[model samples]
Target: MPKLKVLNLFRIQLSLLPSSLGHLINLQTLCLDYSKIEDFAIIGKLKRLKVLSLQHSDIKELTTEISQLTQLRLLDLSNCGRLEVIAPNVISKLSQLEDLYVQLCPIQWNVEVLEELKGLSKLTRLELDIKDSKMLPQGFFSKELRRYNISIGDWPARINGDESLRTLQFKVNSTISLEEFQGIKNVEFLLFANVENGLDELQSNITPLFNEKV
Candidate 1:
C-alpha cells in the first residue's frame, strides 16, 4: 500500500521481493529478519525508511543502494554469517544512523571501514567484530557511543546485559596501549583473554584494573 509504514516479513524464506514493494515510498520500518532473500535493489525506493532489519538474512554483500535510505536510524545485520563486503562509503552516507549491528559476521574489518564509522556523529550504539586487536585503528571507536558490545580477535565473546552496557573483549597475546582507544575510559565491562605478555606494562597503564593479574 502507498501509505504503508511498516512491514514485518520475519522468517519468510523467499528468494526475491515482489516488484510492487518498491512502491511503498512512505514505508518507515521493514523487518526482514531470518529471511533468505538476497536481492535488495528495490529497497532504495523506500527513502523514508527509518529502521531496516536484515538479521540472519542470506545476503552476501550489502550494496550501495542501501545508502539511499538517508533517514535510516537503525540498521541491523546481526547474525548475517554469510555477509562479506559492505560497500565503501555506504555506511558514511547514513548520516542519521543511531544504531548499527553487524556482530557475528565474517566481514574483514579494515581501517577504511572504521574511518567511515567515525564520520557517523549521531551513532549512539554499535555491535561489531574485529578479526584481531591489530585491526583496530587509533581512536577507532567514537566516544559518542553510549552502548556497544565489541569483540576483538578470534575468541567468541558473550553479548552482555541486553545491550545496556558498553563492553570490550580482547583476545590477544600482544601489548596494547589502552590510551589509543579513547572509548576505553567509558567501557564498563572489559575482558582480556589469553593475555600472555606486557602484564607489567598493562599494570602501569590501568592501575585500578591491573593490581594483580591472576
Candidate 2:
C-alpha cells in the first residue's frame, strides 16, 4: 500500500489514524468522515495530501503538524460537536486552503484566530458556526460564501449575494423579516432555528422571503 494515494475510512469505526499513514507521501485525499479519529498528529506528514474529511468526528484538537499540508485545499469538520480547541496559528498556516467547513463545533475564537481568518488570501468557500452575530459587519462573512450554517443572536442587515449561494441557514434569536434578505434570492436550501416565535410562525414569516424570490 506504499503507493496508495487515497484512503477512505468513512464509518470504519477506527478511533485513530495510524501514524504509519504519514508514510504515504503520495497520498492526495484522506476521507475519515464519521470515524472515531481523535488523534491526527501525524496527518500533516502527508505533505502532498490535498483533501481531508473528518465530518461528524469527535475531534477534540488538531495538531500543529497539520500546518505542514501546504497543499491542503478542503477541510471538512462539519457536525464535530465535541471539538473545543484548535492549536493556535494552525489554520492560518494552510495558505492554500480553498474551502473549510467547521459547523456545529464549540471552539472559542480569540483575536489571533480572527486575525488568522483575515490572512487566508486563498480562502473561497467557508462554513462556520459563530456565537455572535455582530461580527457580520466586522467583515466576517465573505462574499464568496456559498453554503452557510450560522447561529447568531441577530439577523444580518444584509447578506451579500453570490450566484453560487445555495444553502442558507439562520439560527437567530429575534424576529427576522424578508426585507433583510431581499438581496439574496437564489437560495435553494433555507432554514431557521432558535427564533423567538414558534416554528410554524417563523415559517410563515420567511415564506414570502423565499416564495417571492421563486
Candidate 3:
C-alpha cells in the first residue's frame, strides 16, 4: 500500500487507526464519515493530506497534533454532536483550510470559540452552530468565504450579506419575523431554519422564494 494515496472507510469497524498509518506519507484524502472512531491523532502524520471528512462520528475530542496538517484544505465535522474540544488554535494552525464544517459541536460555548476561525485567512466556506450570536467577535464572517451556514440562538443586530456569498443558511432558533431577510439576494442556495412563521408570510419577506433550501 505504498502508493495508496486515498482511503475511504465509509463504515468500517476499525474505530482507531494504528500509529503506523503515518507511513502513508503520500496519502492525500481520508474519509472516515459515519464511523465509531473515538480518537483521531495518528492521521496527522499524513503531511500531504488535503481532504479529511469525519462527519457524524463518535469522535469526542481531537488531539493537538491535528493542527500539524498545514496542507489540510477541507475538514467536515457535521452532525458530530459529541465532539467536545479542539486544541486551542487548532483551527488557526490549518493555514490552508478552505472549507470547515462544524455542526452541533458540544465544545466550549463562548465568544472566543469563534476567535480561532479569524486566523484562517484562506477560508472559502464555513458552517458553524452559532449558539450565542452576541458572542461573535467582529468580522466573524470573512468576505472570502462565499458559502456560510450559521445557526443563531439569538437575533443578531447586523448580518453581513456579502455580495460574494454563493450560499447562505440562516438558522434562527428564535421566533423572529422573516422580514429581516429582505436584504439577502443573489444566492444559489438560501435556507431558513426553525422560523415560526407561515409559508405565505415567510415568502412575503424574502424576494427570491424559488431559491429557498430546507
Candidate 4:
C-alpha cells in the first residue's frame, strides 16, 4: 500500500488517533484541531512530519518528543484550554520554526520561557492571550520583536522603552501615558481595544506624540 503523505484529521470528534497513523511516515501536515485529542504520543513516530496544528483540542501538556520533528515550521495550539507546560528545550531545537500561535492556551508564562525564546532567532511574530497581567514575561517588548498581539485581563502598569517594535495591538483597561510613545520610532500601527478610558482622552494623549511622526 502507498503511504499517506497528508492528513486533515481536524474536527473528527476523536479523542485518540489509531496507532495505524504511525505507518504514514511521509506525512507532512497533520491537523487534529477541534478534536478531543489529549494524547500525542501516537504520532511521535512520524519523523518527517511538519506543520502540526492541535488548536482547540483538549491537550493539557505538550510532550517533549514534539522536538523530534526538526522540520516543523508552524505549530498552532491556539485554544488548548488545559495546556499548562511547554518544554523549552523541546521548542528550542526547532531551528526552522517561524510562526507559533499559542493564544488562549493556559500555559504558565514565566521569565525563563521568555528568555529561552530570545535565542530562537527565527521567531519574528508572537501572539498571546493571557488571563493574568502578572503572568506576562519581561523583555517581550524588546526591539528584536517585529509584531506583537496581546490580550490580558488588565492593562499593564507601564508600556514604554521598546525601541524596535513596529506594531503593537493590545486590549487593556489602564491609562496610557504620552511618554510611552517616545523612542518607538517605527510604530506605524497601534490598536487598543476594550479600553475603559474614553477615546477622546486617549487621542488627546497620543495625538501630540505622533504629530511629528505622522
User: What residue pairs are clashing in model 4?
Assistant: none
User: Which runs in model 4 stand beyond 4 Å of their true positions?
Assistant: 135-138, 143-148, 152-167, 170-188, 191-214
Instruction: Give the CA lDDT, 0 to 100, for residue 176 in model 2.
Output: 38
lDDT (tens digit, per residue) of candidate 2 on 1-214: 8899899988867677777887888999998888887888889789999999998887888668888988999999888878887778899899998888876777765545755775788886777666554333344443444454444443443233354555666665443344555545445666566666687777666677666652
Candidate 1 accuracy as TM-score: 0.89
Clashes (candidate 2): 0
Root-mean-square deviation (CA) per prediction: 3.2, 6.5, 6.9, 6.2
Residue 189's lDDT within candidate 4 is 54
What is candidate 1's lDDT per residue for 67-90, written digit by digit as tens?
A: 899999999999998898888889
User: Quick one: ranking by lDDT, best first?
Assistant: 1, 3, 2, 4
CA-lDDT, candidates in order: 0.81, 0.71, 0.71, 0.68
Model 2 TM-score, 2 decimals: 0.69
TM-score of 4: 0.70
Q: TM-score: which candidate is best?
A: 1
Clashing pairs in 2: none
Q: How far is candidate 3 from the true structure (C-alpha RMSD, Å)?
A: 6.9
The deviation in Å at residue 33 for candidate 4 is: 1.3
